[model samples]
Target chain A: MITTAHQKIGTPSITTLSETIDNETSRSRIPGNTGIWVGIFCVLVEFLMLFSVYFIARIHNPEAFLNSPDKLLTIAGTTITLFLLSSGYCMVKAINAIRSDQSKTAFRWVNLAIILGFAYPIVKYFELSWYAQHGINVKGGIFFGTYYYLTLNHLVHVTWGLMGLIFVSYRTVKGGYTSESYSGLEAAALYWHTTDILWIVLFTFFYILR
Target chain B: MIGSAEKTWFILMGLTILGAVVGEAGNVGWPLTLSVVALIYIKSSIVIDHYMEMRSANQRIRNVLRLFIILVPMLVILSFAWGEEIRRFTTLS
Candidate 1:
């Protein structure tokens, strides 16, 4: 009977050790590369298209959409900022815990990160709903249309990030990631950070610099 | 970690609020608005490059990504600029 110690793949040579660790580090990845670059490109293109629509409308009637920066509330902006930055830190912490063999700690941190991720969209929901109630329809005018469209598009991205976090967290709890092999963790962390960075941009444009 | 993160957020939040206030067209002028936009763009770049860890990505990938980031925003703004020119021509006629 070949016990785990006798497993040829897990042999102790540094090269084998390196590959084994790398494999464990990223093993829970759902088959094939998630194509991290493609995901990044997708988000980039979406943001570009959104701005393109705004500029197209603006070009047609710049005077019509000369809006005062008043609809963006500071409270809403602060809430989102707090959640996004903290959630990113929590994800990093979770990765660190997993690397140190503290499975339970890793699980806890991932949960915390996921909770923060979920909270972001919820906060955005309240803010957006309020805007809608105030007769600020996305099609109300060029200004309202562009404003609502940009923020709502970003909210959708947040939803996707939250789901990804949930999946990654589940895998972490299942012992999919180890100190040596944790590519999935790296990929998830990268995704979460991208989401965080994108939100910062969204926040600045739609809220602070509106 | 919490302290550093919180401090950074506070600083950024303060700067953003100040920029917004100063950039208000009602108070400052169109120039300030443009300046604020510039600052926001710079800030966004920092978030993407640093916090997002794009700084450590493959060189080719990073270049491609950077090009898109620059070009996309410029194109959006260019559309608006072209529209303004068209509006002016119409007014002259």
Candidate 2:
């Protein structure tokens, strides 16, 4: 074993430098945390089963699938889609800002996300009321059954995400997170993004696919 | 360069509008359905890769998330394309 010059000089050797670089590069960089990913995975699995039901129902009654969108209010679907997307964008900005050590900006961005997120249920309420007035209840048919179930399930997820945002936003305003420690904000953002993606798929299925 | 978040948001919003326009155009066919499905795939991918920052994630996590996103649109397109065959196949079981 030859003694390297750096070793003789009491400095780090080339092997040490390379090992440090490798360790840094190979480290698993999880966004949010492991717990949030597990939650996201469960949400995806739940939606996957729901989507299977939708496909099977549509396969059995293609006409109902084709004609279903004609009776629903496309405007409500579009509005909710826009709201979720905007909220998702704000949450992403919040995470980005926090990562840059701009906690105040992050707080403002998260607040925007929460505000936009709250608009979702409000819009859904009016949309449902409109559906009721137009006799588009669950009793309408199988198509309506699938529609109500899927949309309501998504709405429930959105509400949970909103609650998460509120808590995260409060912590953010209280200076609970910083660039070095912001996993909670990132977790909340991940949840909101997941919810946004779900709504996009739902919008495509219920409003655009027909 | 525009921020990634803003860029992705614009792309998502544009795709949403484009999907609506295509849906409302009364163009009924596999082409239209496939186009809509393709749009959904792209939107989901953008959200995963950019918004969720999965682009730099480990391959295992990225692929798992991608597979989940791709499944629904694939099933939807397949069902749309082969509804009669699927219905018959299911009924025979």
Chain A TM-score of model 1 versus the true structure?
0.76
User: Which pairs in model 2 have colliding backbones?
Assistant: none
lDDT of 1 by residue, A27-128 (tens): 333321358667877887777677666656556665554453465565777677777767877776776677798878988988998888788778878887
In order, the first chain's TM-score in every candidate is 0.76, 0.87
DockQ, structure candidate 1: 0.22
Judged by DockQ cut-offs, the docking class of candidate 2 is medium
Q: What is the lDDT of candidate 1?
A: 0.65
Q: How many clashes in candidate 2? A: 0
**Span of ten consecutive residues with least summed lDDT in model 2 chain A:** A1-10
Q: Model 1: per-residue lDDT, tens digit, B3-82?
A: 54445445555655565555344443345445545655665565555544455445455566567556644653454446
Model 2 vs. true fold: TM: 0.90
The positional error of residue A67 in candidate 1, measured at the CA in angstroms, is 2.3
| Model 2: chain B TM-score relative to the native chain B | 0.87
